[model samples]
Target: MNLLLNLILQEKQRIDYMLERYQEELAELPKGTIAEKKVNGKTYFYLKYRDGRKVVSQYVSKRNLEDLQKKLEKRKHIEAMIQSLEEEKRIAVKVLEG
Candidate 1:
């Protein structure tokens, strides 16, 4: 019983550390989606996102579109990870309390 409690405590510590690190990483990641617009037989890409109460759209050059898309996808993956970790942490706390 003692060993199990120790393991749980260690796991809780690790989760806390990882949650902080993931949040910091998330803050640095870009937040937006790629939107394409057609004009005069040509397609242009834009990065669209909300800024406060207003929506902002920034034009994205073709050369940078792929890189931007990858970053946005990475941000989404990190968000999912953060959510999972939060749930895990909540469970860990409940177990520790009992």
Candidate 2:
């Protein structure tokens, strides 16, 4: 039982570490126009235009950049949690079998 518990704990820790790494990658995404907008306050962030038509770069705003950063952080945290849980499960299984 003690071995099982220890395995679960170690697995959880490993998962958490992987998740943190994933989040870090997300946070490091290159800065660019992720979206666009039009006159009249209408947003058009998904579509990209090369010439003609007014298009606002979504990543151009400081607020958007900040929001992205926050999102990245939040995602990273969640991922870490998920990894930890998965590792725990794996370790539990191994211990139970052995």
TM-score of each candidate structure, all chains considered together: 0.95, 0.38
- Write one digit per residue (lDDT tens) for candidate 1, span 5-91: 899999999999999998999999889899999999999999999999999999999999999999999999999999998899999
The lDDT, on a scale of 0 to 1, for candidate 2 is 0.57
> What C-alpha lDDT values do all the predictions have?
0.93, 0.57
Shift of residue 14 alpha carbon in model 2, Å: 18
Best by lDDT: 1
Q: Which lDDT tens digits does candidate 2 get at residues 4-85?
A: 6776667766666776666666456433234545758864343232445565333345446557656545655666676766
Quick one: RMSD of model 1?
0.9
Worst 10 residues of 2 by lDDT: 43-52
Alpha-carbon runs more than 4 Å astray in model 2: 1-60
- Model 1 alpha-carbon miss at residue 3, Å: 1.6
Q: Model 1: residues >4 Å from true position, as ranges?
A: none
User: In angstroms, what RMSD does candidate 2 have relative to the true structure?
Assistant: 10.2
lDDT: worst 10-residue window of model 1: 25-34
